[model samples]
Target: MISALAHGYGEEAINIFNNMVRSSMKPYRITLVVVLNACSHSGLVQEGVRYFESMTRDHGIVRNQEHYACLIDLMGRAGCFDRLIKQLEKMPCELDGRLWNAILGVCRIHGNIELGRKAAEQLMELEPQSSAAYVLLSSIYAALVFKKKKKKKYICCSWKVGMGREGETTYGGDWRDR
Candidate 1:
């Protein structure tokens, strides 16, 4: 199943999962993560939702943060932002960096500046020392600038400014503010 997913064969991975179920082999938590990830990467939104919805009922495996992340990623990659937002609101688990990161990624892909900024802010609060969120936010801003054919200059820089590991620095502002 992992090999199939790594090779971009999501259908094959799903087939393997079905075979495992038919053979009476109960899947582990990580197994569901991989399957959901496969569904996300392969654009199998319906299948992914089915598997996620059935995780606890059919397989007795409770959904966790990783599962929610995969489902969010799946929905976001499909440009189902409305549905994704609804799902996020109802998520049983607490929102974390992983979930926000998934949302940010989809926002970036869809050029949703509002939601992207929210996601980025949540990520920054959850993982302030990490530069990934800042970088992604800048990318979204860059996309917006290019889309509008704006001539204003934009600047983004992230680095550590002090001896403490927690002293991460990031500088960014909207070109429109210039």
Candidate 2:
């Protein structure tokens, strides 16, 4: 199922999941993880939320760190920053360094500098010796610098021909960074 999902076969995996349910085969943690990942990959935000709710409501699978991480990642990727922050606040267990890091990474990607800084500060408070936390903060600074600089950016692509016309080609280095 995971292999299928990884290969972009989300609909097929969903069909298999439904078949498993029809056969009365209970889904375990691993199955939930795979489906959650598929939900993220396919941008099935609503389905991901439903499945997360069902994990505790129907299956009685206690939500753990991994589950929360996946949920946060899905919500963050969907640009549901408010909900993700609220969920983080409501976590019963003290969030591990990894969870904070994931949130910080998303914040950085979305250019939410304030939120990223807050997450970084929280991470530092939680794990003072974590090199990852430092790196994430540094990345936020680097992104800000790049945004301010507005340097020219170029993309290069190379093509190779193995047929009768043996040749090399390059294209697309014209776009200016802004």
Candidate 3:
């Protein structure tokens, strides 16, 4: 049910969940995680928050980092960066680099450069050698540079990685045009 919701079948998943509950089936931690994730993906902030609260109040499931991460992602996607940051700060357990990375990614999407930089700094401090951190920082710089250029055009960077002896994959415009 949760996976279905995450994949954009919230109504069907809710029906399934309701049926399960009616049948007296108890939800486990994984079930909660999936449902929360689905709510996040669907941008159902209020529903997500209600389920998150119920996780503890009704189900007695202690919120873990994964659960918090899902909630943060949901809030971020809904443009509630302030609330997301507050939730992050109040997290009871120490957060891993992935959580910070998710926040940074959302900040970048929303053009919140300052917060993105702070999140990147925190991520670097937590995992200095993370390739993803460097990539994200570089992307932020590139975005800033593009804003300065104001070229009224979009640029895409593409590359391929593979090991093959007999074949090759070619991209871009027709070879004859070259």
Candidate 4:
């Protein structure tokens, strides 16, 4: 199922999952995560939400951080910010770096600076040494700047790309220093 999803065969993955369910094979937690992920990648928002709710209700599978992260990723990819916020508010567990990274990733795709900033902040707080949050947030900033200025502008650290000579460190470097 995951292989199908990785190959962009989201619908095929879901079909395989349904076949397993129909064959009376009880899905484990990871199985449901893959199913939800397939739905997210396939743009099956409603189906993903249904599956998330039904995880415990219908399948007796308790929803975990992975499940919520999948749901967040789904909503984020779909640009359903309001719905995603509501879902986040109702999350049973504390939001972790993985979940925040997923949110940051979606924000980058959607160019949502406000939510992206929030996610990036949470991620940086959770994993300060990790560069993923910085990189993604910079992408979001660059996208917004491009949209507004109608041109390419590097928005990394505190410097723009191509503005410095080789070995001079055109980038602003790491955020941990500041």
Candidate 5:
């Protein structure tokens, strides 16, 4: 099932999981992680939430760091920033590099400089030697800068009194900002 998920076959992975349950096989913590990851990759936010809740509520499976990370990532990918931060705040385990990296990546996607910087700070303390956090933070800043510059227009005017001065104006920098 995990391999199916890793190969981008989310529906197949879920089918296998349902079969596992029907066969009276219990799911472990890693099973929840794999299923949640599949849901995340497949953009199944609601299903991921159900699986996350089931891990503790139904199966009595304790959520370790990886499981929490998966939940965070699922929420983050779905743009559930408020819920994601709330879950992060209520975490039983200390924030690890994986979780921070997930947060930073989402912040990058949303162009959230403030939260991205905070996430990077935490990541720096947790894994100072790694440059991932630094790069993500820089990316967020660069995104912000790009957005700001996107507002400034570059106008090209050609003399054409007959045509009411035919002119073309466009954003002059990287096309991504547009």
Candidate 6:
């Protein structure tokens, strides 16, 4: 299920989840995790929200921090900053680095430096040792700088003929500092 979702087979993942439900396979927190992730990736924001909002009501699954994090990622990717802000404020669980980092990631995507700084501050306060927020902040700045300087961002693309990709590829590859 997770493999299908991770590989962008969102419909397949949904079908699996439905089959699980029909078969009475008790879904744990992890099941919804992948479901929400698939929805987020597939731009099924409304569906994801339905599942999240109905977790406890329908499946008897209580939303934990991770669940909230997935919702945040979903809204962030969808560029619903206004709704995302309201959801963040109303989040039942305590704010954590993961949540803040997710916000920072979306801010980076939306070119929202102000919100990105705020997320960075919050994440730094929560997990000072973690470098994820710092790296994301750096990326935000680099993007802003690139726009200001109008630098031709040379996307590094390696091509071994008959290997894989044919055109210039970009490296959004390095998500982890490690």
Candidate that scores best on lDDT: 1
Question: C-alpha displacement of 156 in model 3, angstroms?
Answer: 10
TM-score ranking, best first: 6, 4, 1, 2, 5, 3
Better of 2 and 3 by lDDT: 2
Q: lDDT for model 3, on a 0 to 1 scale?
A: 0.76
- Per-model TM-score on C-alpha atoms: 0.81, 0.79, 0.75, 0.81, 0.78, 0.84
- Model 5 TM-score, all chains together: 0.78
Highest-scoring model, TM-score: 6
List ranges where model 1 is wrong by over 4 Å. 3-7, 150-178
Q: What is each predicted model's overall lDDT from 0 to 1?
A: 0.88, 0.78, 0.76, 0.85, 0.83, 0.83
Give the alpha carbon lDDT tens digit for every residue of 1-178 in model 6.
Answer: 4646644887678788889888988888888988998888888899889989888997899898888888988998899999999998888889887788889988998888999999999999999889988899999998887777666444355655556646654554322121
> Which regions in candidate 3 have their CA more than 4 angstroms from the true location?
151-178
Error of 2 at 27 (Å): 1.1
lDDT of 3 at 156: 36
Model 2, which residues run further than 4 Å from truth? 3-7, 151-154, 160-178
Candidate 1: residue 122 Cα off by (Å) = 0.9
Off by over 4 Å in 6: 152-178
Q: Give the per-residue lDDT of model 4 (tens digit) for 24-103.
A: 98889998888888888889999889889989987999877889999999999999999999999989999998899999
List the pairs of residues colliding in candidate 4: none
lDDT of 1 by residue, 55-106 (tens): 9999999998999999999999999999999999899899999999999998
Q: Candidate 5 clashing pairs?
A: none
Task: Give the Å shift of residue 98 in candidate 1.
Answer: 0.7
**Poorest 10 consecutive residues of model 3 by lDDT?**
169-178
